[model samples]
Target: MFNRKHLEAILITRTELRLPRTTPEAVGIRSTAIAALLDAWKESGLELHSMMILRHGQVAAEGWWAPYAPELSHMLFSLSKSFTSSAIGLAAAEGLLSLDDAVISFFPEVAPEEPSANLSAMRVRHLLMMGTGHEEDTMGPLSSAEDGDWVRAFLQVPVGREPGTHFVYNSGATYMLSAILQKVSGVKLLDYLRPRLLDPLGITEGTWESCPRGIHTGGWGLMLTTESIAKFGQLYLQRGVWEGKRILSEEWVNEATSKQIHNGDDEANDWTQGYGYQFWRCRNGAYRGDGAFGQFCIVLPEKDTVIALTSGTNDMQGVLNGIWTHLLPALTEDVTADPAAHEALSDKLGSLTLEPPVLDAASPLESEVSGSRYVLDENQFQWTALSVQFESQEAVVTLENCEGEFVLRCGRGEWAEGRGVLLQGAPFQRGANHRMASSFTWRDSETLSITLRYIETPFYVTSELKFNGDELTAQQQVNVAFFSPELPSLHGRRS
Candidate 1:
């Protein structure tokens, strides 16, 4: 049934029905409203990478910050959960599985000995709703176990309360959903959706990171371009029908997006509004699939619009707040044409860029530190040796660590792109293809500072190297960290 000819046919149909492009005024949205949203984002200190606004199934505005282009597939983090949930929906439609099925039924071999009553009552729907009954998140312990058998480890965890009685933001539960889908379908989550969802949607460049056992990481690690995310939202907005064909059953879409449980009592908090199957309901009668660091796919049925964005900011709520304040009120029922506003908004979107690090004249200290090897005492980073070489416009820094010799070329003021692996420290490890944009500046006559930004991820590291006569000290700090608020500084001395 999964043949090349069928996949090609689906792709052709998707291209024929590709989302139309139009001016904001052609839709009911005012161009000035989008401009105001951008202004609000900047004022909120949010670092935006890319965004696309759609109205009436047509793209009204889309742009990417310089260095982060529209073609690049950004890491979606937990936004991947929405796609995984879709895969389960497809499997159910095919009669391969049912939402009421006991999760343990799919993995008899991994089932715990004498499963607890709570575990026994756990259903697939419970996993979908984050109602696993575990008081706290189980991903930490389940992922850290040495055996690397995530299924077995998760099953062994004590289900403290009856299934569906409570809600905990459990990523492991989503992972279990992926594992169950794979168990029944005999394929990974991504593969299962390739022909059924992605091909039909014309998303050709989707990828998902796999665990040690080669299973797709359902709760995280999916990558897609901004337009692809917008397409997914548009599909859900159309009630699972793309063009004339029904890609997903309308019944499934309604159930998946409807609030399944009460997540919190605070009505003021957006996250407390409600939660569906891997979808978060908003106060304005909308829902979204979002990830860490502000990756969002918002579906606004009331406005006949969808907004997709990828960002590297800690204040995710701030992004949503900007949307509600700036974009929500602008969605009118009738198109309002303002050529001046459209031109201004177009110019601003075309010129969007992240500010580069400041550059200053080379210091006299450069002559003293040029090609100097710094030998260090024991430090938290375990960096053994370091060297710096000054060039006309950039500095080349080399360091020896447990992983081996690593080199980074830092631009004087601009962002210089380089590929390498950033060691695991703050939260998680990245792939070798990870790209970092680096900049260097002389903080003073005696101090040199360098900033390395993993553009694909949210965090950035700032290193300060201070020189006092022949002695040198190095300190590293993270702008925002996941596991810890503050990281220990590494100390070193020049030999």
Candidate 2:
């Protein structure tokens, strides 16, 4: 039960989620292998968010780190570039546009009277290969610009070299292709690719961040379930064939996977495996779509395998190093039937689970926020800009600095337990945990109040909650990250 539905659409057909032929009886891996792999993976000190192994197309093994579920969607970061590249391929196959089309074609109205020669020479292919020859980085300049116009501005930058002569990781360049796709197709990148690829592949629940004009952020801001990421890898593994249908032409896939661009001296260079359209070459002779904080869709051609993972890490290259070192050695060219190993592995794999949320670890969490009690409102709440709110089933509690409100219902009778958990605005925004502690209490039997506490203790986040009827408020204190301090206290009562 490794559920990647929230992280990405990982649908391995019962037929595809099989172990190597040498291993029958049960497709599950050996218990020893599972222990060794997890030990090796965690040894790096980086949390393993989601991991999937496809053996001859079947899911051989899968797992997740604590507080992270196979169902939760993790941000794809720059690995988003690969999806954007695939969208272009799907669009090209449908005759919506051509890869060789001029870069200027997408925005005749936006280009300057005297466009740079390098700008004129750039093509869709160039964008896919990170050969745009523009600025070395993207998000910096484009962050504040309008969505429709951002691509053109990116194209206008001075050329670092001739269009195809150099290889730089240009996120803005990827964003431009994403922008161009919308401009010409007359539709968002997600919508266009939804039916052609996502729906067919059963990739659902993917989230894309949008710019002011409502275009999905092309180079980044994609969140996918772990399963969805795996589907992408499998699609690449099968050369674009799925369920007896050819979603993308093998030619396009071959071209995209081939080294169309040259990267640098590092081990994971695009040039090493030879850059394809949007994919880069990995150390294992594999082509991969990777993102910041370690989101990866790695397709191993020679090994006839695929490994898709979503992680939060500062060192991406080191993440791959862990896989290459431990997992690679687990494979053997000499195949043999090992039914006992497979069964034991399957049982061990089944043991992995995420701990349930502690609703009442602190006895103080048990109380009823009742009646309309106007407690002391702190001027400190107005210090931050984030919206915050607090509420109770039979009580009124109000807070400043909060943009949203949460209402708590009594679980039992007069001695009802706390309501739901209160998390901050959003988690993963600053690459940190969402920290909020919420509890409720009843006041005068006519009103209820809630208090949320937050503390980020450098290494992790801890929270405390206190609720009394006369006053309704909450405090967010984090030990890990320092968010703009905002305090919002409000009381809720049946009106």
Please provide, for model 2 over 382-462, each residue's C-alpha lDDT reduced to its tens digit, 9 standing for 90 to 100: 322211132232222333234544343222112222323334342334423323223344332433233332211112222
List per-prediction Cα lDDT, in the order shown: 0.85, 0.61
Residue 284 C-alpha lDDT in model 1: 91
Q: Compute the lDDT for candidate 1.
A: 0.85
Poorly placed runs, candidate 2 (over 4 Å):
1-31, 146-148, 267-274, 333-340, 353-495
Let me know the TM-score candidate 1 reaches against the reference structure: 0.93
Candidate 1 Cα outliers beyond 4 Å, as residue runs: 1-19, 359-361, 378-382, 402-404
Residue 54 in candidate 2, Cα distance off native in Å: 0.4
lDDT string for model 1 (347-429, tens) is: 99887777556755478999888888888777666778888999988899998877788898988877777877775466545
Question: How does candidate 2 score on lDDT?
Answer: 0.61
